[model samples]
Target: MLSVLTLNVQAAALPRARRLLAWLDARDDNLIILTETSNGPGTAYLLEQCRAAGLDVTHTPSPDGDRGCAIVSRLPTTARPDLLAGVTLPGRAVAVTVNTESAITVLGLYVPSSDRAPAKVAKKRAFLTSVIDGLRGLTEGQRAHLIVGGDYNVISRNHRPRYPGFLSFEYEFLDALEQLDLADAHQRLHPTTQAHSWIGRGGNGYRFDYLHTGAALTPHLASCDYLHQPRDRQLSDHAAVAATLRLTVDHRTAVSAPLAEAAALS
Candidate 1:
């Protein structure tokens, strides 16, 4: 089984970094994706600490030097340069192919937050549309597994926002994701479960962070859950989400030592 974790480490402050490092050191996940990082000295130091903790990490700093995304894996990972594009607003997205039981392309994303301004709304919609198109292109000639997780900042019919968080265009774009065969990992596991990953204004809770895996990998999915302890303890505003998958050995061509161990552990 391969365990993947996703979290938004809020601006990557020093205190948050300390908490994150300690927490990460205690867990033995195969891969971890982080969002909302900055290019500031604090975030850089945190990334260094992650590497020192024995993780192979890759990061993309935002254009303005904040709100970036990162991917860290115990298994060897190669950044997919083709996945880098202008889809993301100012902050960039990062995608890496993990050499594990199977070659799984894991994407770390931080979608643009909703705003009152029309320009900002348009930007968000365009980014979401581009993301769907890119995913379609990436999986065209490949049989590799796909895992996308991060802060989507959108809502579905069953999941209502505190206020007017997600617009019609945003919802439509998410609906388009189904055409790419992506399924919400948590919802697939527990269709009736209601959970929140982040708290918005007036204490309105929302599940902005999610792990969406390719439908082809559904049979291999073991579990997907949210670890809210960090947010509850004020470690970060967003809770950490984790997904476990049992990959078939036949699909794997390149297996790293760490990934092999992870499979053995499962």
Candidate 2:
């Protein structure tokens, strides 16, 4: 099975990064997407350690004070930065084509969060628009085998409790993805279940993270669920989401040797 996990790291510092690295070392997910990353020592350390453990890591560091995303894969992958060239914040979106039985292009995104401020709202809206344009630019074949996962910061139209303050454009982003033929993996598997990835200070819950699969790959989605251990353990404020696909990667090409070796050295 092809296992994929996505988590919002909350722009961790060096200390938290170490803890995050240790936690990641204990997991065997084939692919991991880290959101809310920064171009700082913390993200650097985490990516470096991932590489040291023989994983294929891809990240486009955000500008000095910006936040971004990263992708760490055990299966071989080729970076596809060109796919999101039109993105307003290129670093916030990282794309890669994983070399599995059927090539799957994975796009990890860290959509900008906005408040009532006009500038921030405009920025967020523009970024969301650029994201749609970027996806629209992809070829039909690419869209068929794509997986988009990230911390969207926007709840669905039917979100329970219906938190106030979200703009219409934010909701349109999800609608646009659906129009492009991508389906929410978690929602597909548990249509009646209510799960939260991030909790607000007021004790409210929000499903801010998601994994959406292309039409062709949606049928192969074996399972998709949220893992709250990370949040409960304080590794991150947001729960991690994992999805399993009925697919296989070349075992010989997958990275397990270095992780095993690192464990032995320790």
Candidate 3:
């Protein structure tokens, strides 16, 4: 089976990155998507460790002071940078085609978080719009093999406790994903269940992280659930989401870049 997990590293520093790497190394996931990454020592160390462990790593460092995403896979993968070339924050989204039993294109995303400030609002809106446009550009077959997941930074309209201050555009992004045939993997399995990946100082919970599977792939989604160990252990402020697919991976070919080269890029 294909086991996939997504977590926001919170741009961890060197110390926390080492601990996070240890935790990740203990998991048996085939694919892992890490969001809120940076071109810092912490991210570099994490990527290097993954490479040393013989896992393929794909990452495009975010510009200085920016955050991005990375993909770590036990199976061979080809980077698909063209997929999100037009995104406002290109580094925040990375796509790779995994050479599994049935080739799947996994896109890792780190949507910008925003407050009431006009500039931040515009930034978030633009990125969300570009993501929608990018997905729309995919052909029917491509969409069918896609799995997009990460920190969305926006709660769904039906989210319980209904925190206020979210603008229309934020909600529209989620709507657009569904319109594009990407079903919320977690919600599909637990329609009436309530879960949160992040919590605020006031103790309010928000479901800001998600995993959306394309229409064709949704049927193979065996299970999707949130794990709070990362958060509970203070590894990160956000919980990790894990999903298991009935699909299998081809173990014949496992590719990974050299540690030196991977470290240089990170």
TM-score per candidate, chains pooled: 0.87, 0.96, 0.94
Which stretches in model 3 have alpha-carbon errors above 4 Å?
Answer: 254-266
Model 2 error, position 5 (Å): 0.5
* Residue 163 in model 1: lDDT: 45
Candidate 2 — what's its lDDT? Answer: 0.90
* Candidate 1 lDDT tens digits, 1-266: 78889988888677667767667656667788888888876577667765655568898776675477889887778988677664655355788888865578888888878675888887777888777767867754342378888888776666754446456776675576666778888988999887799887688888888888876676789999999877887878999999899864332432233322332233
- Residues 107-192 of candidate 2: C-alpha lDDT, one tens digit per residue: 99999888779999998999999999988988877888999999988888999868799989999999999989999999989999
Name the lDDT of candidate 3: 0.89
Off by over 4 Å in 2: 258-266
How accurate locally, in lDDT, is each candidate? 0.75, 0.90, 0.89
Q: Model 2, poorest ten-residue lDDT window?
A: 257-266
Find the candidate with the highest TM-score and give its number. 2
